[model samples]
Target chain A: MQFCVIGLGRFGQALAVALANKGHEVLAIDRDEQRVQEIEDRVSQTFILDSTNEKAMKSLGLSEFDWVIIAMSSDLEASILTTMIVKDAGAKRVCAKAATDLHAKILKKLGIDKVVFPEHEMGVRLAEILSSPSIFQFLELAEDYSIAEISSPREFWDKTIRETDARKRYGINIIAIKRKEPYTDEKTGNIDYREELIMAPEPSQKILQGDILVVLGHNKNISKLEKATR
Target chain B: MKQEEIEHLLEEAKFYILNNRFEEAEKYLEKLLKEHPQNIEALFYMGLLNELLNRLTEAREYYEKVIELSPNHEGALEHLSRLQGK
Candidate 1:
């Protein structure tokens, strides 16, 4: 896949890096010379140019890219103008970042194919983290499914893996366990493990309170576990 | 004037308010008010928090304060009128 990412801010940088790491060709552009220099090696192409200028963007021939993502989170004008130019340049798909509902509506009216709200996404993730302190981490897989890392709760403390019917009762499958280790060598000259953790723990292992459990399941089941832990 | 800090807190409060986290939003706005006691935006938002929480007395007090501090605060006057059964 070929991707053109406008604005080299945090969201844009992350998207460009991830796509490029996944072997997709990514063209990253920003007006800031320093930011473009920072990602020069990571992406297939990095350019410094004002995206709001239609002629400047046209010079790059953005229409050749398979996906064009406008990631200016702060500058609504730049985001809107870039989206319009990308679409007018004949890009098949254009996704724009919107800071608010009004911006999303305007982008939609201007023919943007998709509107992304990073703040809303972060808010939802923060709410989930706040609701489940025992969860090491969580990701929204889809509308119904989720992937989460839940540490063994107090109620499940000292319980063997076989004792709890998490798979049947909660409808969650434990994919792996993350176990912690100290930094020091117990038998020889001191060499610390430095509180590092390991993943894909044995299935039959008893989960301790601190042991992080990686689970994949539906959102309802994930919420059930969260409520139970709470 | 530390306008940047004020704006940051206002943004945080707005986010919490939009998510229906009234208590958190109130905390943020209260801190912001302590820093800028005469801030019309903070006063107006404090009144909004009180109204959403159904604390009519506190809401009225904050709304009245906003009007007193800045008579031209359009939102505060509108909110105050709505709260006064007018």
Candidate 2:
């Protein structure tokens, strides 16, 4: 896959580098020479040109890229103009970052394929982490639905999935279980841990004390389950 | 069962629940409820057992029953209020 990221802010730079690390071709563009130089070695290509310049943007032939990302939320004019130029260039897909609600609405109005608020999402993630320390990871699928990884509550330490009755009781599904098993390294005479992931754990499988349960359910039910940990 | 025997059963259930032996607690509570359906202590303990097991709906129902029987029951009222707030 090929991706074109306009703007060299933290979010855009990270996205470009990550995509490149995943073996995708990434073209990182920014008007600042230093910003472009910092990431030039990490991505497939880097260019220092004002993205608002339609001629320069069109000259890159962005239409051939798999996706174009407008990541200049601080400069709304530049972000919007870049999005328009990318769309006019007939890019396959376009995703833009919005600094505020109104910016998001305008991006949507512009028919952007996707609009994201990285700062807002980070704030939400931080709040959830602080409120539910037992939750190792959480992904909100929708307003009322989420998938979370939480440590098994004490009451469920030795209980099998069937006994716990998680689905019927809390209206949540335990989709996976992650456990760490310790083994003595014969050669080194030291203990090492191996991670085991159980996908679609069976009803008879017992939940161990240190197991991490990956659950999917409504947000309210997930919160109820989290409260059970206390 | 005699009043003393009913009290004994509720005590045993409470003990099991405190020790996190929810299955045993549930058994005792179930037995007490069968013989003394209106026993406030038995109903409250059953509600606590359900709450521990994250069977919130069932816990709420049990708590509601206790409140129905004894309007001024502190434990039942508190537990039900907390569950409802969730």
**Deviation in Å, model 2, residue B79 alpha carbon:** 39
Clashing pairs in 1: A183-A192, A183-A193, A183-A194, A184-A192
Q: Which ten-residue region of model 1 chain A has the weakest summed lDDT?
A: A188-197
Candidate 2 residue lDDT tens string, A1-230: 99999999888899999999999999999999998999999999999999999999899999899889998899888888888888998999999999999999999999999999888877876677667757777888877898998767887888999999999999999999987554445774322346689999999999875578999999899889999887
lDDT of 1 at B81: 81
TM-scores of the candidates in the order shown? 0.57, 0.69
Candidate 2 docking band: incorrect
Provide the lDDT at B26 for model 1: 85
Best by TM-score: 2
Model 2 per-residue lDDT at A220: 91
lDDT of 1 by residue, B1-86 (tens): 48898999988887766554556888988898887898887787788766654455688899899889888876677767876851
Instruction: Point out the worst 10-residue segment of candidate 2 chain A by lDDT.
Output: A184-193
